[model samples]
Target: MYKSQRELKKDAVRAFLKDCKEGRFDGAYVFSGEEDYLKEHYFGLFKKYFLGPGDDQFALTVFDDMSFVLEDFLDELDNVSFAMSNRILLLKDVDTRKLKGEPRKQLLDALAAVPQGTAVVFYYDSAYLAGDDAARRARQSEITALGKSARLLEFSRQDARELVGWIRRHFEAEGKRIDDQTANYLILVTDADMVALNNEIEKLALYVEGPDVSREDIDEVASRSTGVNIFEITDCILSRNYDRTLRLLTACRLNREEPTVILYHIGVMFSELLYVALAAARGITSVDTVAADFGVKANRKFILRRYFNAVSTLNVDFLKQCIGLISEADRNLKKSRLNKWTELEMLIARMISAQIRK
Candidate 1:
């Protein structure tokens, strides 16, 4: 079996946790990746290790991209804590690559010059990393310089199996138990964001009367994400349930989802369906292979079943037609003055009509 990105990061996370437990000190560290929950969880561990049963509130200083001052940050690094613990400086979501010219050089040099007794952490939120192409390129370019002076660690999202296991463990800790199918259902409805998942888990644990959790309970209590709603919308279209499709789309609008955003996800769903159809025609039936080839996140491979099933009934030509309709709607959204919801409903109507004519 091929090693996944999460599997590759496991050793690093283990080592880091061990170092924190053992009080191993590094001058500077960089935390960046898609898994925000791990970053925060491990940071809590590190804080406990460093602070240790004392009121050492002054030992740690935090700064964000907007609030960071190079001189002030350097000053904090230079100062040793009187409380006998190492001083720690945290820089949150500050990508040094965007600094430009001399400021960028100064920041890199400062990272290298971090005193032995002080530790600096640069945390990159997934939101920042998920930015436009230009920002991503800058992030890539900064890694070389950042790597020279700091230990770089990435906390990637877990695979589906791992996440399901994690969900079970969380419920077990809360004195409740959830089966795999219900766990997966929760994942489907809530999307894969761990912080959000944690919140929902707490809600379910409190809301459930018995020890066991059910899918019906999840349907009753857990909040649905727009991504899941998009999936449902696609499923409705595929099933030729025009009324439910329009109702769901209207619900999305009421929830304040933009037409462009909804249209974008619809376009992506159709595109992926087209890719799966092409792969099927080429005699590739392995879900794992197709998902890996399509660059689907490991945690989201469970979604491949829906895509494959949808593609089984959909010809490439129809999928292409759906994509074309999406493109035209996108153009209309940009230039035409038709009510946004009406354009979207018309798009759905046309997609369903195409399927009927088939």
Candidate 2:
């Protein structure tokens, strides 16, 4: 089977940790990627392994925010500190590739000749090396150059399997239990980032009355992403709960979610629901079979099930009308200066009305 980038990175991170635990040290390392939480996490472990307890200022040097000087870095690297046996120099947000000609050569040469018991870490914080197309190409070029001299590790978001396991463990640590399915559902509704998920897990642990976490508990307590809010709004519409639907739409506005973004999700929801409706008509009702037909990821099969729950109440004709309404709203949102919430409210009314007439 083909492995994903995230899976490769996850395996690399595991190997890196194992090496650290076994006292294996690299001369210089580059930490780069979108997973800020894990990057910061492993950096803590890096310090723990390299500097140990009660780290001294003399043992560690941090150069950040354009404060790095080549001479100063070389001096620090060669200082041979008596305060500690393992010394580390951290270069945060420093683009070493900017050093041209001799300076760049010297930097590489310094890395090559890094003294025993000393280590250097070049950390590219999230989004630091990314922007436009040119910037991204430049970042890649820099990473390629640096990779030749340092151990390069990219930290990105974990796959759904890892995230699901993490959620289950967090609940377990809180003296509560959550099954794989419910934990995965939490990930679906909430932000998948570790920081946000951690906070949500804490909230759920404290708010739940029983030992086992349920989907109901998650729906009641977990923070909803814009996607989740729109899902709820669609569900309410299917149930003919107009008041609750309008309330959720207003809540989306209050949360500062853009109407265009909200409309885009609404369109997607209808499209998926239409697919479910068609599948039901064909007597293909299994969530897995429908999800596979639609190319939905394994982690998101719950979404298909949700749509299936509401599909029995609707038919293809009404779903097609809803999509047409969304397209019209999209045009209005682009062409006019109408009160955005008013436009969405009107769109909701029309969609609900379409269901009523159907």
Candidate 3:
């Protein structure tokens, strides 16, 4: 059956798991995507499946394609497995866009003629194909040719619901419980990177020493990702919570977040708020429309609603003034000799004071 790229991506994990269960070993495979955790996890599974309980050093071959010679890779693939029925060859960081002319043709030809007992896997850690359109097209053509004789799997970011389920299972495996609300809170406070989330979960499980992990536990222990802290600062500003705003800003600085980065995020939040405010004035209250107009993801609709409500009482002139203040602070951070911290603190103070006066 023919499937679109989107469909293939959507079912990539499920298909791989099916192949794993059925013991289907294709001669060649391609693993590319943004989700490093999933890619690495599946790679481990493949290793176990192919190598079994034997010493992997004899059966497994890994190469960093950046420095790897194509001829050497082909030589290794042609060699029979010493300790297993099949040899597993892993090529990491295979940036196809960089491969051109004779080397490219030789690699593609070698992939097409992979030995019967050899399983070759190309792993790309990047989220997207790099280079100009021509280079990208050439890489896509190579991938398409490989797809005819292999499995091309792409791992994308999991949405909120998928993340929630993953969090639940992670806690359950440790004989601990995390309620949905608490799980959602954890997701909000952290960047939705599974690797980071897993680390936090491990830390929380070890610290709680209880059957249930609570929201308070997460608040006390989980490191707030930079993006989350930035959002919190903006939320505080929108709600007119000056004390909380300052505390969040302090937390950001303590975490070693750069002053300019903080200012940049503040600027973005105000700009978004200004757009929402203008949209509301035109009587556009539909979440879908607002999301489409402002590029907000579905999972973040609730946060957008908060922004919409907060901005309802704010006028355009005030929003403009806030943006102006942020811009000035940004320039000062880059050009002025003043202490960056002091300049940032003054910027936040001025924004808060302006909001209070409004």
Q: How much lDDT does each candidate structure score?
A: 0.83, 0.83, 0.79
Which 10-residue window in model 1 sums to the lowest lDDT? 76-85
Best by TM-score: 1
RMSD of each: 2.2, 5.2, 4.7
lDDT over C-alpha atoms for residue 108 of model 2:
95
lDDT of 3 at 268: 70
Clashing pairs in 3: none
Can you tell me which runs of candidate 1 are displaced by over 4 Å?
1-6, 81-83, 140-145
CA lDDT for candidate 1: 0.83
Q: Model 3: how far is 184 from its true place, Å?
A: 0.9
Query: Compared with the true structure, what per-residue lDDT tens digits does model 1 show for residues 1-358?
Result: 7876666678777898888888886778888778899888887777778666666577778899899887777666667633356777889987676678888778778777776667788888788776556978778567546867788788887767888999999999999999988888888887777888899999999999999999999989998988889999999888889999999998899899989889988887888788789899999988788777987677667777668877877898888988998999999998888999999999999999988877
lDDT of 2 by residue, 300-340 (tens): 56677778878787889999999999999999988878887
Cα lDDT for residue 193, candidate 2: 65
User: What are the runs in model 3 whose C-alpha is more than 4 Å off?
Assistant: 1-8, 80-84, 126-150, 240-247, 259-302, 305-309, 314-358
- Candidates sorted by lDDT, best first: 2, 1, 3
- Please say which candidate is ahead in lDDT: 2 or 3: 2
